[model samples]
Target: MKKLYHNYIDTFRGLSLEVWWLSLITLINRAGTMVIPFLSIYLSDSLNFTLPDVGWIMTFFGLGSVLGTWMGGKLTDKIGYYKVMLVSLLGTGILFVLLQFAKTFEAFCAGIFLVMLVADAFRPAMFVALSAYSKPENKTRSVTLIRLAINLGFSAGPAIGGVIITGIGYQGLFWVDGITCVLAAFLLLKVLHPKKAKILDVVKVENPVSAYKDKAFWIFFIAMFIFGFTFLQYFSTMPLYYKEVRLLTVLEVGLLMGFNGFFIFLFEMPLINWLENMKNSKTKLIAFGLFLVAISFIVLNFTSWVGILIIGMLLMTIGEMIAFPFSNAFAVERAKKGNQGEYMALYAIAFSLSHIFSHNVGMQMVDKYGYEFTWNFITILALLGVFTLFILLKVLKKEKNT
Candidate 1:
């Protein structure tokens, strides 16, 4: 027992301070940004907006995020990661503060769009920085740790935000989010110094046309696009499903999401390490994860019981943890040496496109076909993701032999 305990401690200690700090920053930032999960609730309950209006507002935020992610990648490459991170954090903080003053629905939507744009823009830059700092062998673990922190923060944030929303209202949520953003930015500025890279030093004004030409890149992007379509349901439609179909209380919904983060925190590191050692290919892991996710949805279709829902959520979270970071690491590994930023940018674009398409299309499908149909649609997408992975594996194998 003592030996096992000490080994566990030593393993944690072996993780770099940079990884720890980045994870901490993610935790703090996500904890404060609780508005994301409850945005539709705030619009409907607090702001008295219609469902369609809320959907439109979400579309704007998605559009803004698309631009933000692309610009963040380009800026990181052109200037430096540290500078882009600082700017994105500070800009998002200012926007969140402005959001507190939004009285009209239009104003609230506009503020949210601006804030989400900047907040999400920070993501690609952060991903690039984390990847750059990690050794190739450790890169996937590092990314998983960061994602675990995000889930931890998310788990706590919504539950806390629920209490705050119940007591003080949406304005309080905005204030808390803004304060956390400012603090996270300050900490990041203090700890992260950008080491100039050769890519940034060189002046290449050419379009990233070559990045789009990589067949593997396009295959990966398409797979992520399919993944995103299913994934976005968590944000846009799942809460409504919980509320309307399952008849869950606000606190109950928050607790369920919190549980998701808790699982990620507890299991992500061990799972990533285990997966790394598994003889199965990364593509197989992804296919397996998607299969689990599809199975979870099938489980979801039959039950409105909270216990069953929680079980399904657990399965989904495990699948997501296995797939997401691996996809990211694969993209980075596949990039041309000097074009890391461009490759990551395109990868980020896949996510943005997924969000836009899913939110807009998924919501409509939910409205028309109901939750069961929506889940069925997502299951089909998950199966398609598996098929894509098979194709990707064959291509990777052919390249390897060559």
Candidate 2:
């Protein structure tokens, strides 16, 4: 146990101070990530929206993310990630407060679209910053630590959000969420060193278009889209399933979501760091994650018991632990020196694209077919993704991304 303790702490070694601050910012911002988790519920109960209506709203929000990440990525490479992150964080905070005032359905739709557009721009910028900040060999640990901070924040956000939800309702969630976003921005603006050198100081080719032409990147894009599409269902359909199908209350539902963060926090970093030390292949680990995620949804068809929910959450968390950080690291590894932001942007954009189309598809399927059938559909999609990714990796290895 003592040796295990030292090994776990060892993962924290060699990360730069800038990456540490970036992780802190991720924690602070994500800790206030109350809005997205409960957005579908807010639309359904508070605004009296049908499931399909909520789906459309979310799809639009995803579209906004697509714009945010693309533009943010371009700007990050042109100017620098620091400026992009500062503007994004500050602007998004203000938008969260504005969201509370948008009461009518049209107002809500317009507000959500704008807010996510501004909010999600931070993603590509942050990814660029993370890659720029970390030492070469420490990329996996740096990225994993950032995710660990995110889940740590997630653990606190929903529980606190639950209390605020009970006491002051969803509007309270918006206010709290807004305040935290601004706080994160303020920390960045005031404390973060402006003149800090980027990982690659000289800017290289700005054209990410060549990346699109690469057969390898397209394969990566498809695999990422599938991973993102399936992973995102936890926010979309799963919450609704727990409430409407399982008949759980708001706090109970919050606890269920919190379980995902809790388990990821407890297990992800230590486990992944250990795996990295064991010289695990990134693609193989990713395939394993995809299989577990597929089984997590399919497991629900077998039983509606709350235990099954916990079991599913645990499985998906483990999958997330293995898959997500490695995915980011893999992209960074493949990126030619000067165009990391563009690569990261494409990855973020593909993920947001999943939010736009595939998630809405899931929502429609859930509304039409109900939980068991919808989950089974997602399972089939995930399993197909696993097979496709296996073949995809064989091609990528030949392309020498190995």
The residue-by-residue lDDT of candidate 1 on 1-402, one tens digit each, is 899666545435445677778888889998988888888888888778988888888888888888888888788787866788888888887788788778687887788778877887787778877776666677778788888788778778977998998899888888888889999999987776544221222224354445668886788788888887777687768878888999999889868867777777767777777778775677788778777777777788876667888888888888888888788778767653445567777788888888878877877898899989988888888889889988999888887899
TM-score of every candidate relative to the true structure: 0.88, 0.88
Per-residue lDDT of model 2, residues 1-402, tens digit only: 999888778778888888888999999999987987788788899988887788678767877889888888788777878888999999999999989898877888889888987888899889888877887678888999999898888777877898999999899999999999999998887657576544632335555445566676777788888888899999878988888888889889878877777777767778877888888777778788888988999998897567988888888888888888888888777665446667788888888898787767887898788888988888888888788778877896786755
Give the Cα error of residue 199 in candidate 1, in Å.
Answer: 15
Please give the TM-score that candidate 2 achieves against the real structure: 0.88
Clash totals in order: 0, 0
